[model samples]
Target: MTAETNEVKQTTKGADAVDEAIAQGIDFDGSPIPPAKLELYHKVMALEANRQRSGVSNTMRSRIVRIGAKHIPQAELDKMLIDAGFAPLKDKEAAFFYGGK
Candidate 1:
């Protein structure tokens, strides 16, 4: 391919990973992300950005628990939390997040 056909690509690392993915039109799995999906994502994120700020640490913890539970085992996640100087999961959180398993 010539220079005209070569598009500059962003490195999918660090804080700008999502932006890089959007610019490249590809997901981490190497599959092309649909433009419509990207559009909707941008729309929702724009709304989120404009939303009122609460506790930033609270938000981070909530997100970690919500997404982490999906990928990490209960014991492992508890260990990670404690290792990171955060409290381990509460009873209610354990029930809600790890209930099925």
Candidate 2:
């Protein structure tokens, strides 16, 4: 198989493995998921899936801010947001996400 085909197969296999584990209520470490916790998670996710969205850009920005703060330096993340034409990090976000970093 071509490299791209091999990569796709590997990714499919990985996703299938994860889906199977989830369906079996098994965590990656092989522990059984708590039924209550899983039920709550499913309920919340169902609600979120049905919720109306403002726009794709708004969602993108929110995700970038939420996740990027955990991995990127504050200054870099702010620059990236601005460079991408999104709002720079707000004072609250800066304080909350990068406070002790």
Candidate 3:
């Protein structure tokens, strides 16, 4: 198979493994989703709901950006920034000083 195809297969396998583990009740080493996290999720959902009610676009990228701006995951934040026509930087130094790179 081509390299691209192999990479896709590997990613699919990894996702499947994760799904299977979850289905089998395998608990990965991490704290449970905290109340603050849930609150953030709710806040994001509420924002989306407001946008939808106001006939605005409810794009996932926009939602992610809004959430990320509130200090969500870096990778997710980077993706949101990219989707919003901003560059995704590798580190805080780049994001702060260079405005993403």
Choose the strongest candidate by lDDT.
Answer: 2
lDDT of 3 by residue, 68-93 (tens): 55566566667767777765645653
Give candidate 1 regions above 4 Å deviation.
1-19, 29-31, 75-92
Estimate TM-scores for all models: 0.57, 0.75, 0.26
State residue 67's C-alpha deviation in candidate 1, in Å. 3.7
State the lDDT of candidate 1 residue by residue for 20-93, as single tens digits: 77877887656789989989988999999999987877787787888899989999999998898777899999
Most accurate candidate by TM-score: 2
Error of 2 at 42 (Å): 0.5
Look at candidate 1 and tell me the lDDT of residue 86.
74
* Candidate 2, number of clashes: 0
Q: Write one digit per residue (lDDT tens) for candidate 2, span 1-81.
A: 677445434544442776665676776555688999789978988999999999999999999999899889999999999
How far out, in Å, is residue 35 in model 3? Answer: 1.0
- Clashing pairs for model 2 are none
Question: In order, how many clashes per candidate?
Answer: 0, 0, 0
Candidate 2's C-alpha runs over 4 A off are 1-21
